[model samples]
Target chain A: MTQSPSAAMESLSVALGERTYPIHIGAGLLDDPGCLLPYLAGRQVMIVTNATVAPHYLDRLRHTLSGADLEVCEVILPDGEATKTLASVERIWDALLAAGFNRRCTLVALGGGVIGDMAGYAAASYQRGVAFIQVPTTLLAQVDSSVGGKTGVNHPRGKNMIGAFWQPRAVLIDTQTLATLPERELSAGLAEVIKYGLIWDAAFLDWLEREMPALRALDAAAIRHAIRRSCEIKAEIVAEDETEQGVRALLNLGHTFGHAIEAHQGYGNWLHGEAVGAGMAMAAALSAERGWLTGAEVERIGAVLAAAGLPRVAPAAMGVDDFLERMRLDKKNLDSRLRLILLEALGRAAIHDDTDPAMLERLIERFPRA
Target chain B: MTQSPSAAMESLSVALGERTYPIHIGAGLLDDPGCLLPYLAGRQVMIVTNATVAPHYLDRLRHTLSGADLEVCEVILPDGEATKTLASVERIWDALLAAGFNRRCTLVALGGGVIGDMAGYAAASYQRGVAFIQVPTTLLAQVDSSVGGKTGVNHPRGKNMIGAFWQPRAVLIDTQTLATLPERELSAGLAEVIKYGLIWDAAFLDWLEREMPALRALDAAAIRHAIRRSCEIKAEIVAEDETEQGVRALLNLGHTFGHAIEAHQGYGNWLHGEAVGAGMAMAAALSAERGWLTGAEVERIGAVLAAAGLPRVAPAAMGVDDFLERMRLDKKNLDSRLRLILLEALGRAAIHDDTDPAMLERLIERFPRA
Candidate 1:
C-alpha cells in the first residue's frame, strides 16, 4: 500500500515576498526525498526531532534521506512542552557546531509543535540565521503552528515568551502520520482545526458541525479538508501580518486563555489543543455576553468542542484569581492590561483592549469549573 | 560641563526600508532623555551593560532615564568577550521574566559591542521579538557593529557563531563615553575607522594617512570626523544589503581572517579591531600576490595600521595550517571553499571565490612572523 509521493498532492504558497515558500500536503511526502531536497540550503541537512518521535519515524526518514547525496545529522531531544527551553536550543547549537554546520546547512524539524519551535528558533539564531524546513508530524502542527512562522519556546512565566518570527523554507505535511498519533493528541489537534472555523470561516464551522463524526473517525477526505482549510486561513492571516502587528492577532482568539490554562496546569499536563478548546469556549461565552455572539452560538461552540473530545471547562483548581494571574503574563498584555482577541461573530474576530477587569473576573468565575 | 542635548550633535540614519533606524552621534547623549524616550516601546526599559562599563557610565545613564516616566531595570554582566555566551543570554532571559517585562517593554543596550550584540539578541528573541535601542559606548561600536543589525553571541566554536539580524529601534552613540575608554581600546577602535578607508573611500584613506597623528591624539574634531565617516559608509552599505546578501559583505573585509585570529587567541585577547587590523594586513598581502594591488600598496596599508598602534602581523604562534582550519569555520565559506573579501585596488574590494588553496597557503607562509 505504498502511495506515490506526487499522487494527488496539493501545494499552497505562503506569499511572504522574498521568504515565500510552499506548503506541500499529501499522504506520503516523507518517502519522497525530492520533496525535502529541493528546499535545502546545502548538501548538509540536520534533522531535529524528539526521543518520542524518533523511535517511531526517525529511521524511515533517515533511510529516505540516504538516497540523496547529502550529509545528514540528527539531534534527538527529550519530548514535551516542558522540554522547550533555552537550554534545549543551546544543546542544538552545540550539536551544530560540533557537526561543523555553517550558514549553508539546513535544519529539518521532524516532530510536533515543540520540535518545530525549537528547531526553527535554532535555525533563526544559528550563525545569525540559516534555512530550515518544517516536516510537522502532528495534526496540530500540520494545521496551525507549522504553517505560520511564529517559532519560539516557552518561559517559566509564559508560553512562547522567547523566540523569533523566522519563516521556513517549506512545510511538508503528511496526513498518514496522523495514524500513529495518540488518541488524546488527535483530539487536541482538532481543537485548532475547530478554531479556524470559529475565528475566520463560519461556513467552515458549519462543515465541521456536519463532519464532526467523520473527522473524529479520521475519514481521509474529511480530515484533509479540515487541515487544508485551517492552513489556508492561517497562511492568509500570516501572509498579511508576518510579525503579528495587526490582523495577525486575530489568529490568537483562544490562545490568551489557553496559554494561561497550560501554564496553570503546568506545561504538558493538558495538551495545547485541549487548553485551546476550553479557552475558545470561554472566548465564545464572553463574546456572547458582549452581544457580539448569541447565547445559542456559544452553546454550539461548546457542543463541537465536546464532540471533538476537548475540554469545554476550566480546571477546578484554577480559580478566577489564578486565571487572572497567568493571563496577565501573556505577551499581548501591555502596561499590565490584558488584551485579547474576541469574536465579533463566529467568522469574525478582533483585538479588544478595553475588556473590563471586573467583567473579566466575573466571566472567569462563571466558567464551568473542573 | 552640562552640555545641551541639541547644542552640537550629528544624526545619521541607517535606511533599512521599514526597519530603518537612526544613529545619533554626539557628546553627552547620556544626559539626553528625549533622544531615548521617543524610540522606547513602553515606559519599561531594561538596560543591559557589563561590569567594566557600568562603573563608568551606568549611574549617569540611569539618572538620565529617571528623568523620563520610565521603569528602569538593570542587568549588569561580567565584562569581556568570554562572557558572551548562551549562558549569559539565558541569565538575562531569567531576569527579564522575573521582572515581568512584556512585549511592549524595550531593551536598551548601554555598553560596547559585546553588550550591544548580546542585548540586541535578547530583544530579538524575547517574547518572539521586542523593540531595542543600541547605546553604543565604544569607538568600534559607535562606528560599526552598533550601526548594523548584526546581533549575536559567540559559541565555543566561533565568535558571533550564534545570533540574529535583529535591527534596533535606534542607535545612540555618545562620543563623550569614549573619554573614559582605555588607550588600547581607543587604538582598537581605529582599526575599524581605517577599514572604512580601505574598503570604500581612497580619499578617506589619504586623509587617515595624513591625520593619523591627530586621530590618535583624540582631537575632538578629527575623531568625530572619523566616527561619522565610518558610520556613513556602514549605513550606506547596510541599506543596500541589509542581510549580507551581496555588496554588504564588503564590510567584512577583515572579519573572516580576524575572527580566526580572535578565536585562536581566545576571544578578548586580541581586541576585535586589532585582529581585524592584522587580518586586514593579511588580506592586503594576499591581494598584492594576486596582482590586484602592488606590494608598495601593501606596505602603505601596513604603515597606516602601525601608525594607529594596531598589530601589523599575525600571531607567530598560529601557523598556516591553524589559520586554514579556523578560517574554514567562517560563515562565508561555501561548499567548504573559502570565500574571502579581497581588495581589487585601494578603496575598492570584491568577493573572491576562486582563491587557490596552494596560493593561499603560500601567501600565509610569506606573512612576516611576529
Candidate 2:
C-alpha cells in the first residue's frame, strides 16, 4: 500500500490474507535482485518466456539472478496469441519435469499476457500448484493480466475457456520495458488504462485526457502513475472477489463484446486491449441506450479512446449475429441469461442480465462499424 | 459427522468452513434425489462417467435427477486409467461449452476415481471453477479418492502430475455400486481401507483384520462401516491441513513408493491401491529396518494386505534403480531430498527427508519380488 522508500519503486499488496503478494512498479525493478530473490519459493527457479521477449530480457534477468545459490532454468516458447494453448503450457511442464523442478520450485513469467497466463497455469497445475512470479514485459500485462491471478490457455471453443485463479508470489512491473513496446502495443495498453478511468474513476479519466500526449510519449512519471493506479484498482476489485462471484464481474465492462471480437477475428489479429477499446465503446453506447448515461457521456468516452489511439468502432466484417453467438458463450453468462457489464456512470459499472434481446439486437444493428 | 436419522444413510462433513460439504454413504444414494439436488449450483448438470459405468447406473442417476427443472447432459468417456488425460478433460469442457453451461453449473463425476479426478479438474478450471459433486462408484474412489478433493490426471511423466485441490460441493457414495465391482478392483479398494488403519487407528486395523472376509463378501453392514471410517479419517486429516503443508502428508504413507510402482507399471497395469498396498508393505519393512517398527509389525501389515488380496511384494521386473528414479520425481519430495511418509509405529506416520540413499537402495534391492 506504500512506496518502497529505498528506491523509486511503488509497492501494493493484493491482500488475500495468507496468499497476499506484492506488486512492485518502477523503472529498473527487474535489474534489482532484491525485488526478485526474496519471493523465490525455493532455490529452483524456472523462467518461462517467449522467443521475442527472451532475446531482450532473459539474459538481463539471468544476470541479476547469477549471484544466488539458485538452480535457474528457462523454457523459451514461440511468440504469439496463437501459441497460447495447452500444448505450449505442456512444453513448460516438460521443461520443469526435465529439470526435476519440484513443488518448492518457482516459475517466473517473463513476457506478455500469453506467456504469463500459460506460465501461471503451468505453475497452477504442475504438481498441483507451485509458487510463481510475474515479470510482465508488456504494458497490457503490467497493469492488468500480471496483477490479477487469472491464468489459463485458450480453448478452441473460447478464450481462457480453461484456467485457474492461481496468484503469483510477486508481480514486478518494469516501466522501462515499455520503451521497447511497439507504438500500437503501447496504444493497446492505454486502452486498459483508459478502462480503469471509465469503470472506476472519472477523476482518473480527466487526468488521462489531459496527459494523453505525455502517456503516448512514454513519459516516465506519467506511465508509472498510470500503471500504479490501474493495478491499485484491479487489486481492489480482485481482493473483494478472488473467484469473481460478485463485483469482479464489473471489471469485464467490455470483455463480453471484446472476447466475441477476439474470437470472431481469430485471436492475435486484434490485440486484446484493442478489442477491449472497441468493446468499451459499444458498452458505453449500449449504456446510453439504456438511459444510464447521456449521449454526451458516450461521446466523451469515445474521445478518450480516440485520444489513446484505440479503435472506437466495431470491425466491419463482424455481424450482429456474430456478436450474439459469441457473447452467449461468455463465462460470465448464467442460467442461459446474458450477463453484461454496463456503464452506470462515467466512473461506475453495473452487471445486468435482464437486457432485452430485441433491444440488444437493435443496438448492434444500428451500431457503427469500422 | 452424524448419520442421517431419516434414512438408512450415514452423513459426514469435510469441514472447510464456507466450502464445507457432506459425504453421504448408503445402499442406494444414487437413487435418492435428496442426496444430490440441494448441492446443484444451478439448473445445469453435466454427468461425466465412463462406458463401463453408464450402462449400469446412468439411467438410474438420470431418473433420480429427473422430475426437476434441470438441464441434464452427459459425457461418457472410455474406461481405464489411460483415458485419464487432458484430452478427456477437454472433451468434458467442450461439452460444457457446447451445452452453453455457465459459472453456476455443477459437474457430476459419476464413475470411479478416474472420472472423479478428471471431472473435478474440469470443474476446477471450467470457467475458472464451478461446483462439482463426486459420486464415486468404485471402492477405491468411495473410500479414498472421492473424499479428499485431490482431483487431477496422470501426466506422461508421472501419476497425478497435473491437478488441483479443488473440493467438491458434496460426495455421494453408494455402496450398492460395489456389488458390480470386479473381485480384483474390490481388493484394490481394500488396500486404501487398510491404509487408514495403519496410519491413524490401531483399533480400525484390528477391526479390519477381523472383518476382511465379511468385507470381501460384500456384507452390507461391514462395507458401510469401512467406508464411513475411511471417510472420517480422510475428512479429519483434510480439515487439519487442506493442502499437503504438514500433517496431511501422513495420508500419503505409502504414496511415494506407490506412485513409483504406478508410474513404472504404467498406471492402469497395477491399480493405484494395489501399488499402494505393496508400497505400504515396503514402508513397513523399511520402518522395521530403521527400528521404528518391529519385524512382527511389518509382518502384520503384509498379512492384512494379503488378506485384502493386495500385492505384498514389489513387481518382479522393478530393480532398485527403477524405484529410485521414479521416486525421486515424486511431487512430495522437496529440495532435492526424498520426503517419505514412514511409520513411526503402527497407526502413526511421520515425514522423513533424511533417509540415506544407500539404505533406501539396499531396502529396495532386498524387497521381495512378486
Candidate 3:
C-alpha cells in the first residue's frame, strides 16, 4: 500500500476558525516553508527547537523563513520527553517575551513530540494564546502529537498535566529530518504507527506486517505511507470528536493503561511509544481473555509490535493496584472510574466500563513480565 | 437602557463546540446554577474563589450548587490583581491535584477578573484543559474579562504573562455578587463598561453616560443590562476576530496603555479598572489630538468615567520613558512597536501603528496626577 513519490498527496485542514491549520504529509514537505509562511501573516517569527534537531535543520528552516520584514529568534532546548515540563515551557515564554513577541507574532515549534508539545503550549499560553506552527521533526509527532492540537506542559503529578487544546495554524513534516533521527526514536514512533492498526485498521496492520523490513530500513515510501495513514485516522477521529467526548475516547485504545505504566515508572523511564506498544499487547490479551478478540488476532498484533522492535510485556515488579491507581488520574478517566478501551476485533474498538475489578486483576496478573 | 428584573434575557453561547457555554446574565441569575448544571454533566465541582468574595457569598453559591453527588472542593485565594501570578496558579493546581481532579471534574471560578483569569488558567492547564465556569463577582469581570475566551496567569515581568484562551463552560453573572463589591471595585468595573462603549459601540457609550447613576447605585436591572450589552459586544468582536487578529485587536481599546500603567505601578498600585479608566481618558485625548475623535466626545467619555469614580489622570511623577518601556513588554507590542487601539468616534475604534512617541510623552505630561 506504499504510494510512490509524487503520488498526488494533499494536505488536510484542522478547522478551528482563525486558528485552523493544514497538516501536510508527503515526501519533501518539510522543505516546503511556503506552506507554513502564509500562516504567519506578520513580520516577526521566533522558532523554538531542541539541541538534537537544531544542528541538523535549524539553518535550513531559518534560511527558508528569513525574508523581508521578518526577524527570527531561535531558542534551542535540550531534547527528550523529560524536557516537556514547566521549565522548558517557561524558558521559551521568556525568550518570546524577551524578544518582545506580541499578539500577532508567530512561534514555530520545530522538533519532536516533546519539543512540539512544550513549544506549542508556550505559544498557547503566551499572551493568552499566540499563533504557533508545528514543525514536527520526529515521526511520532508528525503523525500523532502535531496534528491533534493538544498542547501542554507536564506537571509533577502527571504528563501533560497542564495545557490547552489549542489548534495550530500549520504543520510542516519534513521527511528530511528523519534522516538524523536515531533508530530507537524511529522505533518509538512505530508504536503509534502500529497502534492505528491495533485499534481500527486490520488491513493497515496486514500492510505493516508485510512492509516491516522496508520500514525498518527507513524506506521513504514506506515511512510516508505510514505517516499519512496514521494522520488520516487520527484527523478523522479528531474531526468527529474533537474533545474526546465519545468516539475520541476510543482513540485512547491502550492510552489509559499505557499512561499508568509510564506514570508508574516515572515519565521518562519508559519512552511513550514503547509503553504504548506494550500496553496495546496487554489490551489485546485482555480482549482475548474476554472472548472479544480471537487468539490469532491477538498474536498478529504482538507480531507487528515485535517486528517493529517494541516491547510486548509489562514491567517486572509493577503492581496491579498501583497501575489501577494511576489510571484513575488519567485524562480519559470519568468521575475516577477507570474507562478501558478494548478492541473487539481488528479494526473495531469499544470502551468497556462494565469490567469487573477482580477479573481485571486476574488478567493483569497474567501479563508477561520484562 | 436598563432592563427590568424578571425581564427575559437570552443566554449567549460561545461557539467552541464542547468548549461552548452559555453566558447567563440577568437579575438573580447568580443564584441559578441551573444554566451551569447541564454543562457540569453531573461531574464533581471545585469552587475556586478569593478572600474578598468568599466571606460575602460563598455560602449562597455553595448552597446553589449543592446538588446530590456533586462534591465541592473550595480553594480560596487572596483578592487583588497581585494574586493573579503563577504563585497563585500553582497553588490552585496543587489544590486540584491534592483533591484528585481528573478530566471529568469542573472548576467554578467565583471572583473578580483576577480570580477568573488565574482559575481559568488552572482549568486550561490542569490536566491539559478541564471544564470551567465563570461566576464573575466584580463589575470589571462581569463586563469584560468574563466574556472573551481569554485566560492566563501573571508573571513577575508582566500581567497575564502565561495563559490561554480557554473559554468557560458557562459564565454566571449573579448580579448579586456586585452588591457586596467595594465601591472601588465597582468603579473599576465601570472603566471596562465604558471601554465597551468607546471601542465599537457609540450607542453603548451614550447609554453608559445615561445609566452611570443607576450603575453607581448598583441597581440590579442596570447592572444586568450593562453586563449583557458588554458581553454581546465582546462576543460579536470575538466571533469576527476571536484571537484579536484585526477587529479583535480593536478590543484592546485602552488595554494596551492601561496594562502599562498597571505594570509601571507594579501590578497592584492601581486596580485594573481604575488604570483602564484613566487610560481611556488618555486614549480619547490622543484620538482627539489626532483628529479621530472630537474634543466633545473625549470630554463626554471623561465625564462618564469621573462619574463612575474612576481616575482620569496618570500617577504623578511617572516618567514617560518608564511608561514606554512598560508598554514595550505588553502583549500588544510587536517587536517593541506599540500596537494601540484608538478611538475614531464613540464606539468606533482603529488600530494605529507608527504612533508618535512624542505625542505619548505629551499625553502623559498633561494627564500626570497625584
Candidate 4:
C-alpha cells in the first residue's frame, strides 16, 4: 500500500457466473451509489439496519439515496451475531411485503456481519431473490462477509449452515462506521484484516505488522487500506472459484478450524473473527507441525493477530480433542474427509486434502495448553 | 401430440450459464431413476411426500433409492395450496439438520405441486442450495410448478409470494402417479395442462380439446402424453425465459386473474388448477373485452375448461372491482405496472403490458356469468 498501490483506486469483482457483481473500494463511496443504481429496481428503497450504527450514519445514507424514486423502509434489528437467525429474516421480509414491495423492489442492508448476512439472506429468499444492495457497516462485513455472496441464516447445528450464494447488486462500505464500533468489535474485525495478509498477501502482513499501532488506534487511512487490500485479494479468489470449488476453498484458510471454536463456544460467545484469529494460530501450529510453515512464519502470524488485540492463543477451556470433533462437521469436508486450508508461507494458501486425522488429533491434544 | 409431434423429443435448455440444468419429458419415466442418481449426493435420502401420495407409489421409490446410502426421512405435509407455509419449511429444515445432514445430502420431493414446491425451497435455503430431485406427482406440478424452478411458500397476503428460482438437480415425473389422483384434482391439474396449450402450444390445445373425454376417463396413455407434451412446452418457454423477463410472463396466461381468485377464496377452497381453469376463462374474457379476441375465442376457452369439469367462470360474490384490487399486489407486477398473459387465440398467448385498468375490470364482469 506504499504510494497507495495506485491512488487511482482498486476495484474487485466477485464472479458468480451470471450473478457476478463488483466491489468498489475507495473514499466517498457512500456519497455516491450512482454506480449501482442500474440494479436498483422500483422507486421504493428499504434500508435494514441495526441498533448500534443507526444513530451515527443512517441519515447520511438516507440523504445519498434520497434522489431515487424510492421510499426508505428502515427496520433496525438488535445488533449482534446472535441476531443472525430465521426470526430476524422474517421481520425484514414481512416489512417489505406488507409495505407493498413488488418484485422490482430493492433492499439495502446496512451494518456489520450479522446485518449483512441476515439482510443478504432475506434478499436472497425474499420473494425468491430480490435485488439487495450491501451497505456493510463494519470492518468485518466490508473486508469479508460483504464481498462474498454467501448469504444465509445460521442453523442451530452450525454457523452459515443454511444460506444461499446470492450476490449483492452493490456493496457500500463507509469507513466512517468504524468510529462508532467498540474497540473489541474493531479488534475482531482486524482478524479478517490479518487473514488476507496471512493467506494471500505476505506484503500486506508486513504492512500490517508495521502499521499495527496505527490500526490499533483505529487510524482511518490504515484501516481503509487494509479493507481495500483484503477485498482485492478476496475478490480475485472468489472470481476464480465462485462456488468454493477450488480457489474459494483457499479463502477458508483458518475457517474450518475457526468454525469449530465458534460453534463449540456457541456462536456469539466467540466472535467469528476472534475465533478465526485463534483458529489461524491453531492452523499455523498444525502447518508448522506438517512442515508447511517454519517457526518464524508461525510466530509472525501470532505477533500480527495479537498486536491487533485479536486472540492468538486458544481459550483456556477449549479441549483440543473436542475442537477436532467439532471441526469434522465443517462443510469443507469431502465425504466426511476433513479438508484444511494451510498456509504455504505468507503470500499463498493452499487447500490440503487427505489431512492426517492423527496429526489433527495431536494438535487437539495440545489445545488447553496451547 | 396425438400423432407424437415431438420431433427429436422437443428439447429446450435453461441457460443459466454454468449452473444450467436440463428438463426431460416422456411417459412412464419415473420407473427410471438412473438419470437422477448422478445428482444425488450421499446415500442418506429424505423423500418428502404427502399422505395422499404415500400409499400410491412410495414403496417403489423407496425400493429404488434403497440401493445407495439412502436413509429415507419421509415427511408427510398436508395436501393443498394452503399447506405451503413457513411452518412446513421449518419442519423440513429441522429434520435435515437433526439427521446430521451436511452439504453432502439430497432431498427428493415426491408428491404434487405443494410437496414439490416446499421440498425444492427446503433444498434451496437448507444449507443455502442443496441438490434436490423433483418428482412431481400431479398434472399441475408436472406441467408448471415442477419446471421454471419457482419454489416457495405462500404468505398470508398473497399466494406463491415467497419462493426462490432454485432449480432442481433433476425433475422426475411419474405419469403413473396421476392414475390415483381424484377426479377433481386431476381436473384441476388440467388447468395447467390446458395452460401450456393456450399460451404457447396452440396445436397441443387442439389436441387436448379432442382428448378431453379420454382424459376425463383417466386414460393413462393420453394422460401421460398430455403431461409430457405440456411439460415439454413449459420447459421450452422456461428455458427461453427462466425468470419471467418477457416471454416467460406469457406462461402466466391465466395466473394474473387466477392468483387473485386463489387469494380471495383463501386458497385451497378452489383447487389451484380449478382457479387456473376459471382464471383462464377470465383471461380469455379480458382478451375479448380488449378486442384482442372475438366472442368465439372466449366461448371456446370457456367451453373447453367447462367440459373438463373446470369452473370455466369466476364466482359472482367477489365483484370485478374487488378482484382487480387483489391483482394489484401480484408478485409479477413490476411496481404499479400490471402484467397479464392473454391469449390472442387458442394456443397463442402474449404478455399484454400497459393495459387499461378500466378495460380489465369490464372483462372480469363476464366471468360472473361464464
- State which candidate has the highest TM-score: 2
DockQ of each: 0.81, 0.82, 0.65, 0.69
Candidate 2: where is the Cα deviation over 4 Å?
A: A1-6, B1-6
Q: Which portions of model 3 miss their true places by more than 4 Å?
A: A1-20, A25-36, A67-69, B1-21, B26-30, B33-36, B200-214, B219-225, B294-296, B334-337
Residue B188: error of model 1 in Å? 0.6
Chain A TM-score for each of the predictions: 0.98, 0.98, 0.95, 0.93
Error of 4 at B282 (Å): 0.7
Using lDDT as the yardstick, the better of models 3 and 4 is: 3
**lDDT: the better of candidates 1 and 2:** 2
Ranking by lDDT: 2, 1, 3, 4
Runs in model 4 with CA error above 4 Å?
Answer: A1-10, A15-18, A33-39, A368-370, B1-17, B20-29
Candidate 1: what is its chain A TM-score? Answer: 0.98
Question: What are the models' TM-scores?
Answer: 0.97, 0.98, 0.92, 0.94
Better by lDDT, candidate 4 or 2: 2
TM-score, predicted candidate 3 vs. hidden true structure:
0.92
Displacement of residue B70 (Cα, Å) in model 2 is 0.9
* Clash pairs, model 3 backbone: A21-A169, A30-A174, A125-B163, A162-B125, A163-B125, B30-B174, B140-B189, B201-B347, B202-B347
> Each candidate: how many clashes?
0, 0, 9, 9
